[model samples]
Each structure stands twice: as C-alpha cells, then as structure tokens.
Target: MAVELIILGVLALTAASLWIPYIVGVNTAPDGSIPADAPDGFIIPPDPNVHRPWVRRAYRAHLNLLEQSVPFAILVLLVDRVDGFSALTLWASIAFLILRIAHAVGYITGTARFPGRPLIFTGGWICCLLMAWAFFAA
Candidate 1:
C-alpha cells in the first residue's frame, strides 16, 4: 500500500509537469493572444494545428500517460487489496514508476524514435504484467 501511494504521488507529479510545455507553448504566441480569427473569449483552446514539434510531442505524451495511468492505478489497488504487497509487487510498482518517468522524458525530448522511449514503455507494461500475475498467482 505504501509503495502504491508513492507511485500515485509520482504519477500525479508527472501529470502536473506535463502542463509546462503546453503552457509555455500557448504563451509563446505574439502577445500571448490567439489567432485574429479565433472566436472571442476562447481561452487556451487547443489548436490541433500547432506546428511546434516539442509542444505536439508533449501533448501526445500527456494523453498517453493519462490513458495508461487509469488502468495502472486500478491494477495497483486491486493487487494491494487481493494479494497484498510482496517483494515482487513492490519492485514492480517501483519499476513502473521509473519507466513512466523515463518514457515521458524521452517523449518530450523527441528521442522516442530511438530505443529509449519504446523500451521504457515496454518495461512499464512488463511491470504491470508482473503485478497482474502476482494477483492471480497468489
């Protein structure tokens, strides 16, 4: 349970940090204003047409993290309730968190095309799989 809570805290922080690139990108426009043709009173509407590679990458990564996190949180809680924490569960939880951080960094830095991002993502999945196996095997 302690390890799960720690991972939750880390995930929350990771989600929060994803906003940095988006906020900076939004404010980068001239005078921090939307396009002249944009509807009035529209604040911070996401423009899918954003051309900046880093900003796009950050947004995609943020969404991806969110998608993965929901299931991860559910699985962690289930494991905590059903199997209780053992060495395998604790270590798997830690590994998942670490891999998530690495994946986010690789995504933001545009290095996802190489080995770092994909490998990190795969490692996270493996951790999740281990946790699931622990639940069933117990």
Candidate 2:
C-alpha cells in the first residue's frame, strides 16, 4: 500500500509538471506584455495558431493526462482503501504510469503515426479498467 501511494504521488507530480511546457509555450509574449487583444481577465485564452507543433502537442498531452487522471486517482484510492494492494493492482498501477509516460513522450515527439502513442494510451486505459476490476475481484 505504501508503494502504491508513492506511485500515485509520482503520477500526480508528473501530471503537474506537464504545465511547464504549456507555460513556456503560452506565457512568453514577444514584447513581454500581455497580448493587446487579450480580454481583461485572470485567464487569457492562448492562440493555438501561434503555438509551435511541439507546444501544441505538449498542451494536448497535458489535457489528455488531466482527463485521465481524475478517474485514475479515484479508482486507485478506492481500491487502495477497499482492497489494499494486491499484485494485480500494484502491477496495473505501475503499467499505467509507464504507459502514460510513453503516451506523453510520443505525443510531444509527434510519433503517433507509429504504434507507440495510441497503443500506450490504450494500454493505460486497460490498466485503469484492470484496477477497477481488482475492486470487484477482491
């Protein structure tokens, strides 16, 4: 259970660190000023057209991680508390972290045309499902 918690912490940190690319891509204005066209608000919309390909990919990867993280966290915590850490749950958690890392790298590197990114993403989803199944199997 402690190891599982550590893995969850690492995954959460990975998700948080994805903001670095997004901030680098969008926060640096040419004149170091907010775009004049930006509406006055705490949250300014970034122009997607202005972002480089890798930057766009980074942003998308971050969004994808965020989308998956919520459910992943919920399921992991529920399983951890309810069933404790079985071998199946522990391996599934590790596989999920590895697959998510591969997915992010493939997305940022524009390698999705190959079998890497899509397969990793699917594998991560399967890991999530497997984790959920562990709750019932326990």
Candidate 3:
C-alpha cells in the first residue's frame, strides 16, 4: 500500500468513471449530441460542442483527465516495479492527485482560466516526470 499505488488506484478509478458524466451529457443534450444515422453499439466520440456549457466542459475535463492519467499510471507502476518508492514518488503522487482533482473540477465548472488550468496540468505532468525520475533517482 504505497502512497503512489493508492494515488494510482484513485486516479484510475476516477478516469474509469468519467465516462458516465460525458455520456450522460451526450445522451441528454438538447441538440442531439450524436448523429441519428450513426450505427448502434459502436463507440462514437462525443462532441462537446453539441452540449451546453457545463456539459461541454465535462466532456473536455473527462478527456483531459484520461490523457493525463495514462502516463501517470504507467510511470507510477513502472516506478513501483523497478525502484520501490521514495519521497519523490510520494510527494509527486500526492501533488498529482490534488492537481488533477483541481484541474478536473475547474475545467468542468468553467472556472479554469488564463494560466491557471494550464499551470495545473503542467504540474501534474511534472509529477509524472518525477515518478519516472524516481525510478532512477532511488
């Protein structure tokens, strides 16, 4: 139960669950989020533009989280497997979860603005790099 592993689990679960909001937004959109002629049972990428503001933000937030989580998860797991853990990994894990949560909330709520959102994203990306670095720095 290392800190990084716990944080990785939480991030993975959050990413896994993000589809619900985006899908709900897609299906409930007033503008008909999907093309009516699209085939059933096939995965269709949801268009955020068709949604209302918050819903559009939700879709974008979910996608952004997924994009960030992949590299974070991979780096954390690789570190755990190859180098055990360290203060760097621990702090990175904690900071990353916080940044990601803030980024997701801010983006979804439309509060993300100016340099704020990008800074948060860059912080999380730095955390991922830190995790990768921990594998060697340990």
Candidate 4:
C-alpha cells in the first residue's frame, strides 16, 4: 500500500497511453497494415475504416482511466501527506493502476475475446471506486 508506487504506476500507464499512437503508428498504415514509416511531428494518416481499432480504443481507454483517476490520486496523496497514511486509498490506487495497465495491454494485444477485456475493465473501475470511497472515508 505504498502511495509512491501508486503514483509511479499511474505515471507509467499515463505515459504509455499517451505514447501509443506515435509509437505504434496508429494512423499511418492502411487497415491492418503497418506503415513503412510514421509521418513527422504529430501528423500521420488517419486510421481508415476503424483499422487497428483495438489500438485506438486501448489508447483512449487508458487516457480515460488516467483522467478519471488523477483527482483520486491527488486526493490520496494529499491525505497521505497530511495524515500518517491512507492504506486503503493507497491499495485501491495501486489496484487501479495495475488493472488499467493490464486492461490496456489485453485489449491492444488481442488477448482472449469478449469476457477477458470486460473483466479487466471492470476490475479497473472497481479499483477506482474503491479509491474514491477510501478518499471520502478518510
């Protein structure tokens, strides 16, 4: 239940989420094909026909998770700093981070279809809820 770890994990996932399109060349290639090279400086071919939709979806999902969790992370850190510690909040935040990363990886990598991604997504949301509850309860 380390708040530092939670923060670090959150930052890790956040960076990965933001970097995916550029790193993976999301919009550069034609449908289901990798581009020979990505375009320069934030401009690239648009994704055609939902090509590589999972990659796009994964990026957005991770970004959304980060957006949703940042406030909770801050609140947890603030409370932890003021109080001795917030074990519940810290654990929940860590859980959220772990689940988010797993969810993104699973979705992007084409892991088992249907239920697996949903479960991971659900796990992340539950962690977020737990973190929020701990923040308020504190």
Candidate 5:
C-alpha cells in the first residue's frame, strides 16, 4: 500500500479513538464537573472554564482531530483516487500525522502554552493544504 493510504488509515483510526481520553476524563472526575447533558438540546460545547481542566482540554483535543480529519481524509482520498503519488504529498501526510499527535498531546497536557498548540495545529492545516495542492500538482 502507498504511504498516503497507510497515513490516511492511521489518521482515521486516531481521530476515531481520540474520544477515549475525554470520556475517561469525564468518567474519572469524582466531582462531576463535566455535565451529562444540556437539558434543552442546546448542545453545550466544552467550556474550558466550567468543565474540569482535564476533561475540557481532552474534549477540545478530540474535537480538533475530528475537525481536521475530514479535510485531511478527503485530500488523501482524492490524491489516491487519481494515483497521484509524489514525495511532497507523502511527506505532508507524514507531517500531518505527527503534527496531530503532537497537537493532541500538547492540548491534553497543557504543555503547548501560548502559541505552541496553535502553531502545531496550523502545521497540520498546512499539511492538508499541501495535500490539496498535490491533487492539482500531481
């Protein structure tokens, strides 16, 4: 299999599993800082201030991966469907995977202070943009 295909698979699985940490955080928080529901179908988002720190950060990390995965997967599929294999796309795919991991870790651990986390996320975004361009450049 091509590296891009393999990376795509990894990205999908990673995004799917990213929810595990947040769920664990919710279940483990003894104080019940995480709400079970919104009551009116308002669908409350994760609040960094309201939810437990770990739960909030973990939830955001999971969402961030999910948000990025769609476009990343689409670009990968497009490139693969066209048989567009190139070193640039390959590297971008690999970079995306790495950046996602780093971003998730940094977010969950709060290690990526200030611009660090955003920079890592932007790197993943750039990787997707590169893959999108690969569709044309190929």
Candidate 6:
C-alpha cells in the first residue's frame, strides 16, 4: 500500500505538471499542433496576449513526461501485485519518481545541461532495470 501511495503521489505531481502546457497553449494561441486533451487543473490562459511558444513547448515536454511515466508506473504496480514488492521494487519506484521529477523540472527550466539530462534519463531507465531485476529475482 505504501508503494501504491508513492505511485499515486508521483502521478499527482505528474498531473500538476500538465497545467504548464495547457496554460502555455492558452496563452500562446489555439495551436492545433499539440496532441491530447488539456487537463482541468491547468488553465488555458484566456488572453492570447501572454502567449510564449517556446515556454509552451517546454511545458509540453513536462506534460509529456507525465504522460509517459504514469503508464510505466502502472506496469510496475501490476508486476508488484503479481509478484510482490522486493528491495528492487521499492528502490526502483523511488528512483523512477525522482528521475521523472528531475526530468520534468530540468527540461522545462532548462537549467541542467547534457549531463544533468543524461543523469535523470538514465536514472529513469535504471529504475526499469531494477524492475526487471525484481522480475527475474522473483
């Protein structure tokens, strides 16, 4: 249940991140370019005057992380349900969440450079590896 909660929490953060793109889009314009429905928490900015396209794209990237990571977490959860949580499960889930958060913030903020991006991306992949380890170990 604790693992489940952490996953839920991660997902909630992911959901919050969704707002960045929606707000960005609304601010920018009704660009049909973006895929997927805009989530409710994030507002579609009423006035186009405040639009910033680059920022919108950056926000979309964060939204993209949320979009991708949640499914992976669900897959992990399903595996956990069947096999049970191991040390690998706990550590991997933690790492996955952290990397996802880092990935979202680093990419959107653009503060972290190549190594930083690699670190977070690798961390996420490592988490998956941990899951695989658990599957094999089980």
Candidate with more favorable, higher lDDT: 1 or 4: 1
Report the lDDT of model 1 for residue 63. 79
Superposed by TM-score, candidate 3 places the C-alpha of residue 7 at a distance from the truth, in angstroms, of 0.9
Pairs of residues at least 3 apart in sequence or in different chains that clash in candidate 3 = none
Give the best candidate by lDDT: 5
Candidate 5, residue 133: CA error in Å?
1.1
Per-model TM-score, in order, reads 0.80, 0.83, 0.84, 0.62, 0.87, 0.65
Looking at model 5, report the run of 10 residues with the lowest lDDT sum: 38-47
Error of 3 at 5 (Å): 0.5
**CA lDDT, every prediction?**
0.74, 0.77, 0.81, 0.60, 0.83, 0.63
TM-score winner among the candidates? 5
How do the residues 1-138 of candidate 5 rate in per-residue lDDT, one tens digit apiece?
999899889988988898888777656765644456634222235555555776778878889999998999998999998988799999999999999999989899989877998889889999989999989887
Segments of candidate 5 deviating more than 4 angstroms: 31-44, 47-50
4 or 6, which is superior by TM-score? 6
Residue 20 displacement (Å), model 1:
2.8
Better of 2 and 6 by lDDT: 2
Instruction: State the TM-score for model 1.
Output: 0.80
Whichever of 3 and 4 has more lDDT, that candidate is 3
What is the per-residue lDDT of model 3 for residues 28-75, given as tens digits with 9 covering 90 to 100? 766555567756432244443445677767777889999999988988
The whole-model C-alpha lDDT of candidate 4 against the native structure comes to: 0.60
- Cα lDDT tens digits, model 4, 51-97, are 45665565556565566567656656665655634667566667776
In model 2, residue pairs whose N, Cα or C atoms come closer than 3 Å (at least 3 residues apart or on different chains), thus clashing, are none
